[model samples]
Target: ARKNGRVGIVTLAKRPWLTESARIFLPGLDLEKLLDELQIPVFYAFEHVSRRVASFGTPNSYVAAKRNAMSECLAQLFGEAKQCSSAMSIGDSEIELLAIQELMSELAMSRFSTPLESPLQFCKTVLLRENPSLVQLQRQIESLANSLGSLVDHPGDLSLELGTGRRLRLRNHLGPNLR
Candidate 1:
């Protein structure tokens, strides 16, 4: 299909037997690496299928789930014009390009109805702010551990003073060997 200038998409089930089959057929070949080299995108049917559709026991429901998963994969493929172009030749048809743009816009709006901050962005915002108490506590723990010296064989200095004026010490009542 690729040699004939047609895009080939593969949909696979999420199962261990696929790997076993690949091992038997190809013998030491990296299936994923081969797929990458061929520029073939592989979509796992179960990954894209919604939980609700997947939960249904009917054969029709199973078909619907597979269809839904395929729809998502196709949408993702066609959603970006550059990606679509790289995958296969869409030519310079203005109408097709305009349609793709419209589809992408629709997909974006449908997927994200409400504005949301990504977890990474939220984490960056949180990390940028300084927390003095946490820093102090961390420093105190480090200091305490340092004061204790090598805790492997023998116990060194057993007492330490924290920055908060609290005294921390290993109990002497436990005797010399403190495992």
Candidate 2:
């Protein structure tokens, strides 16, 4: 209906007679191992929404991320086809650009992630709006990216430390003296 919801999951207790092999859970796969492998930080930020439940981050990040992955893993539980609706306005990209001024010098690839930090609220409100054109969203993302001017030029080996000092040395050339 509204594209996003949430619910708890449970394994059915009743086993009907004449149960087929397809009804059984397949063995041999390590469920814990499978979940640990996902990119937890990414999925936490960009939530997927669809016809079924809208899952959030849990102690079991794998199950949460999987249900959130591609929106409504419950649909898969029902063995139905994926949503035909295409609200995937955002293109496929591993990088989500954030707005940083010239003074700042940190670019983190961790969770609680953000793509833009200026004029902050509006972008999010319009992200799922069907009325806005795709170009508008792209512009928003680009505008957000452009705001982080430091990233545009300082593309080199660098690090951002929390407690200590310098941690990166990149292969960049020094400029001539302006004397």
Candidate 3:
């Protein structure tokens, strides 16, 4: 595998499932020297690869940014490489990273009703707080409340004024003195 220029090598030191031959072969392998001979770059990054998918910006902004940048860089590197296999390499622990990522993504899809738009939600929640246009809405509601309050006078003279800008005359239902 090391002799092939197109084969990307990822060395994992502690794999319990390694076959007897693989166990023997791993100790003899000089990863740095082999990669140098092949002129391939090795990126020792498990933080991003093994990161839990369900975390919608839970860790922090910096870690999320770093993870995004790392993934983007890897993707770009792989896309620009001469061959797909020659572009990237990972450590032993990263062997299960792809599966974990896929499973977590599926879980997130099933678990959440909406896609977590953390930054947008944060800004919107901060700006709007409870109401989107509290002052304007409040003024309108207060005006309506006042109109309703005015209409709820004596039972003998029922006068209900509805709507704005235009006023419609409503005839009184009862006489002047109901006593």
Candidate 4:
């Protein structure tokens, strides 16, 4: 209701109805104390099997995400329900993420090496630069080049779409002669 430019606001009074299994503690949540600690407008939360995870959000999306995340966290923690693999967690969540492999293997009805199939490899900037051997560097460079080429092609026919809509002209940002 305030003139803040945001999709929505989740007030503390109406926040509890977001999830089924997650319990929120309001009296325990000292808003002023938290703001003093974090130095940010952190106000909302989702939950795990135990603990409160608080942060700010865009009401509807936040509440929806909190519901989904709490559900998955409860599932994973209790080993009863399924974890939402794609759910991203904030530092405030106080929840530990079991590797995707663990969740996939546990939920699989048939025996298949899903984890082995999708091994996550992170090449940090420093690691990809000053940290590898010559052969490793070359391999990484080739991989990077391939990724660049994939993005170089147009995502959609931009010319075809704009041609029929109206007369179009390019701005002279590329230098007056080029434009």
Each model's lDDT: 0.39, 0.26, 0.32, 0.30
Strongest candidate by lDDT: 1
Q: What are the TM-scores, per candidate, against the unseen true structure?
A: 0.38, 0.17, 0.23, 0.19
Model 2 TM-score, all chains together: 0.17
Shift of residue 156 alpha carbon in model 2, Å: 26
**Which pairs clash (backbone N, Cα, C closer than 3 Å) in model 4?**
44-55
> Which regions of candidate 4 are displaced past 4 Å?
1-85, 96-111, 119-179
Worst 10 residues of 3 by lDDT: 119-128
TM-score preference between candidates 2 and 4, better one: 4
Query: Taking the tens digit of each residue's C-alpha lDDT, what string does model 2 give over 1-179?
Result: 11131221211112231132223543556433433444111233224433233343332333333334423332443333122211111221211111111101111211114433211111100122234466765655564344334422233322221112233233211111100
Positional deviation of residue 156's Cα in model 4 after best superposition, in angstroms: 27
**Cand. 1 Cα-lDDT:** 0.39
List model 1 lDDT by residue over 82-137, tens digit each. Answer: 23221211211222222223333333334444323111000000011123477875
RMSD of each predicted structure: 26.0, 19.9, 30.0, 20.8
